[model samples]
Target: MENFNTDLDIAIIGGGAAGFFAAINIAEQNPNLTIAILERGKTGLQKVKISGGGRCNVTHAEFIPSELVTNYPRGEKELLGPFHTFMTGDTIAWFEERGIELKIEEDGRMFPVSNSSQTIIDCFINEAKKHHVKVLYNHSVKSISTEAYGFTLKTNQEDIFCKKLIIATGSNPKIWNLLSDLGHTIVAPVPSLFTFDIKDERIKDIPGVVAKDVEVKVLETDLESEGPLLVTHVGMSAPAILKLSAFGAVELARLDYNFKIAINFICHDGEQCMDALKTIKQDFAKKTVSNSTQFNLPKRLWKKLVIASNINETERWADLNKNQLEALVDQLTNAVFKVTGKSTFKEEFVTAGGIDLKEINFKTFESKRIPNLYFAGEVINVDAVTGGFNFQNAWTSAYIVSQSINS
Candidate 1:
């Protein structure tokens, strides 16, 4: 491997979203400051290329920083201020200024109009080049040494020195270990933003069935989430399940990924659901109970619940006994599913733990233990549920870091 010693103003130790954003903004702020991004992979932005199924969800459409911060399960308090400096609206304008327009989906996720992650990658590449930010790919960091006034980073390709350094390495264990050795606390990482693996006859063959509104609660715990729930081939997914997965990551990990979850398909309690069903039976007495769907639920899903409630396809609403009606309400309002395991959600994988939030100053995204050392993105102990919130954290923290370094 080629080896060299060089001194620079700043060195960023990742080439992902936060690294590129910080490098470009910092370089643009101070043209005289030399900057380099050291990436371990042969190509950088691999996550960005695959995020949001290759469309590259840049950020969410939530304009208010205070409201946007709520999406983050870990960094909600710490991110409020940083988001005030830079958030979704700023992100949209940033890309638009670079000649790339973003369009917001119905779910509030913003993506480039080109509908390709390549658009995002190209923008980062051009911005880095335009600002003279050197990107060194395949430069795996081996160690970090601190000097009286600066830091010396030893990588596979070369050893470099810099007055200021930024670690945006996402959830890499090696980098977290390095930070730990440098007197920083590294929070134990756990998988976040995943799907629950479930095996239940009610959802067996209805892979694509979706409940427009639901409330999923983890049995024996206070963990719960409300949103749209999707029945997947492996188990349950979508915002409702994903939100619980993210918020309860630490707790569920302790459970060994085996637990029970209660799902309220119609956002109603058991008593309320039963009353609604009674009213439905009275109104549709002549109709087949299995053929009638209440609460605006999909027909396929209604049939599953009906069968699971011991009501046959030919059972008329008028024949429904009190026991049968109660069973149907129970299935609709308090359906319980056994979560056997967990599965990562495509390339949107995120970790709930990282450099402990206490180690860094939220004002500047700088490490409190080490001056001029900053962090951004998943490298910090901040992660959000599925959606564009995770990317927003990266942008907000990175922008603040750039501003701090520029000052």
Candidate 2:
């Protein structure tokens, strides 16, 4: 392959999910356009290789644009119209047209039937090659400067010029600094989609116990979520906690990772739990309180809660006095724990801040402040909860950018 006839028609920064997708789609549609992807790493699509535990969750099973947009805590309102354009259905069709099939899990996350991220990466690489998209590796952009006709990107290797530019670098501080210098507002980035780190007597020594359909609330804040909760060696995780983390990313960051959360293990009302405990005391009079699990809770978790309520392991249900019964109810319905810190959810490190959303036009994913410049993925202050929502945003925004750039 030649170096190029002249300057590139399009230059995409970052070789990750959004950059690769936008480059491939744009070049596929405009085969005559000269485009190149500047990747800092030796290879591109590193995030795609590790996303969704290496299976690469492509998109969610959600069909409705409005319903799907709700998964994005930051871009919920902005992504509604874009999802209508190239959403989950369009993503599936695009992959299927390329001879790749995706399967939906019970949790609604869609992954390749092969259950490997390599499939998606291979497709992107092949598609880019077919469209003559040059993938330049080890070309980290040192800075970005605008030209009268286009933009100049100063990289470690050399200076590359392009008439149109797209910044797809996700959660990059240097890139953000460049954008900030170019008169764009960058909201300070904070960690998102992380698991809480906790140490408590109730959850000690029980790592894999799961309580389905539990309610979790960040104490003293409006943050609340409910779903299946998993007791990890550190603290609690799963959907219930993940949802809270995504939605409260900014607020939790303000708290300096030190906050208290009240969890309802049973997802039952206080009065209702009390009534049921009394009924259980009468029905299972001879059964040991810690031995009999109720409300579909895991036995180990039930025993922990029972012990935390000041009930002995051998204490029978009939022996729970009124105060003890109340304590048990409180333990089940309003158990509070201290979250000391947070751990990145798997290898997925998502940030809740980026270029201010108002700077970009959602219609074309092009920068309103800088004409012919665009942004996609986590670079645009848009992020979603786990379960394939983040990838969906990538597809939607990159597709829109592709379409717009082609025109």
Candidate 3:
């Protein structure tokens, strides 16, 4: 750990979304104050470069703060105040003011109109340059110490002294480890935004078949999500599954990623399915069971349903008695599949746990226990479901921390 002091007003660790945003806000507010961003990696904004498959989902278009914060599974309650201060609409406006136009997808995820993550990346870099914020890449901080008037950041390259310190390292174990050394509790880290691995023959071949609407219910938990479901080569995926995976990240890990998932392909209840099945059976009584399905499921899936239901493909619908109809209804409403493992959905992946939210004040993102020490972004125990919620957290936390920093 080299110790070389460079006096500054604020020393921000991590140069990802949160760190850069904080730097921009602080520099814009206090132009005379010196600010530097220390990044461990060679390049900053690695996540931003890869998010939304390089298009960079900046934020969701949802303007309602309460509704927006609800997507966060961990820090929803704490984010209420910060979001009220700087919400998604503000994020769009902020970028727009910087000459970056954002387009909202049909799903409500907002991204740069250029349709490339480089646009967003360049915007941040240009903004940082315009604000005179110095970003030092590959300068990893080894430790941070707080003095009466300021903080000292010991890094691999050099030691820096700053009046205010902000940790925006995103969701890395090493970052939380540093925080723990600084006297802060950390919530155990777990994987979020993953795809379930189902060892089922039904969806093995139809890996790309996506249902526009689906309802996923964990067999033993109250966890569920209603949205699009995708068939993967290994099992199932999609927005609905990804959301459920986020909410049950810890629980699923506890179970060793082994659980039974009930997938309602049609997004209907048992009674609705039963009623629909009865009508279909009556209309197609003379047709082969394999030819007529209870719902408008894909033809490719009908074969698998017949085999899984233990009904003969050649059997006529008339041969299907009340028990068979009930069985078919059950299958339609609650198609059970064994989830054996998990797969990474890198486009929207994020960690579930981080610095305990209680240790940091939501109003300013400053540590209550350590004065002048603050945190922002995924580095804290805050995570949200897919669709740009994570990026919103980064922006909101950075804005709060920037406003709190003294000039």
Candidate 4:
């Protein structure tokens, strides 16, 4: 085993988004302090390279601290002050100052004007080099131990000592186990931000059909969300299901990923939907019930629902009986589907658990139990729904840690 005799002033474990952000800011704040980033991967920023399908959703366009913090399910309360200090606006200015201009999409997801994740990777790499931050790739951390003067970090290649340590490892169970040994409570990790899997005649073979602005509620639970709903080959995706997946991550996990969900394709109440259906029946009495798509839903989905309600393709609206009308109304208003499993959403494999938020001080993102030890990003029990909010958390927490270190 080899040991590095020279000790660094700051050592950051994990070279992902939070790790690099912290290293760059800390080095920029204290140029005289020697800092090093130990990353296990042969190349760092892999997630950044693939984020947002290579465009790298940098952050959200949300500027207000209170409104912005609501996107985070776990750290909403603790992050209020930290977000007020450094948030989406600060993140934009930080990148803009570095020659990267971010553009906000219609959905509020901010990405570089170049529309390439490589741009973000390049900026981080260049900033680290310009700030004189040492990025040690392929140096996997073996263990972390507190010493008299500072902390000792044992890696596969060498043993490094630092006066301060930062753990930016995102959702890595091994790192959480190490922190558990260091007297920090580790929340049991569970998969979040997943698409529900369903096998129903309604959504089957309609992978690209999307119903905009629908409401979905998990049956027997209080979990519900509203937004776009997309039909995928396996089941369902899009904002509505994704939001429910995130908010009910723990509960759904407790149910073993098998549950039922009711979807309001029209986003209307039962009576209102029935009234609307009756009006449609009168307006299109001569037209075939299956042929006339109402509620602005996709024709294919409407046909499926019509058929499910016992109305045939040749059944005209005028021939539809009261029973059929009620069935159609029920199917439209409270359609239930069984979710047998879940699938990851693109490259954003987010988890709901991490280092318990109560153990860390949001002011500096420093450990309350262990002084000089800090955390940022998913290593702590903080995660947000889809959009660039997760990256925003990384930037805000990392920037604050840098500021606190300088103070």
**Which 10-residue window of candidate 4 scores lowest in summed lDDT?**
1-10
TM-score of each: 0.97, 0.98, 0.94, 0.98
Worst 10 residues of 1 by lDDT: 1-10
What stretches of model 1 exceed 4 Å from their correct place? Answer: 1-5
**Over the stretch 1-407, how does candidate 4's per-residue lDDT look in tens digits?**
22344499999998999999999998888899998888998899988998898899999999898899888878889999998899888899999999999999999999999999999999999999999898888888888999987899888888899999999989899899989999999999999899989999988877999999899999899999999999998999998998898888899999999999998999899999989888888999999988889999999999999999999999999999989999898889899999999999556789999999999988899999899999978889889889998899999989998998889
Q: What's each prediction's clash count?
A: 0, 0, 0, 0
Error of 4 at 239 (Å): 0.8
CA lDDT of every candidate: 0.91, 0.91, 0.85, 0.91
Native-to-model Cα distance after best TM-score fit, residue 208 in candidate 3, in Å: 1.0
Per-residue lDDT over 1-407 for candidate 1, one digit per residue giving the tens place of the 0 to 100 score: 43333788999999999999999999988999989999999999999999889999889899988898889889999988888888788998999989999998999998999999999999999999999888888999999989999999998887899999999989999999998999999889999989999999999899999899998999999999899989999999999999998989899999999999998899888888888878888999999987888899988999999999999999999999989988888998899999999999656679999999988999999999999999989999999987888888998889999999999
* lDDT (10s digit) by residue, model 3, range 177-260: 877887899999889889998877777787788777778889998888889888888888888898888999899889889999
lDDT tens readout by residue for model 2, 265-288: 887899999989989999999999
Better of 1 and 2 by TM-score: 2
Q: List the residue pairs that clash in candidate 3.
A: none
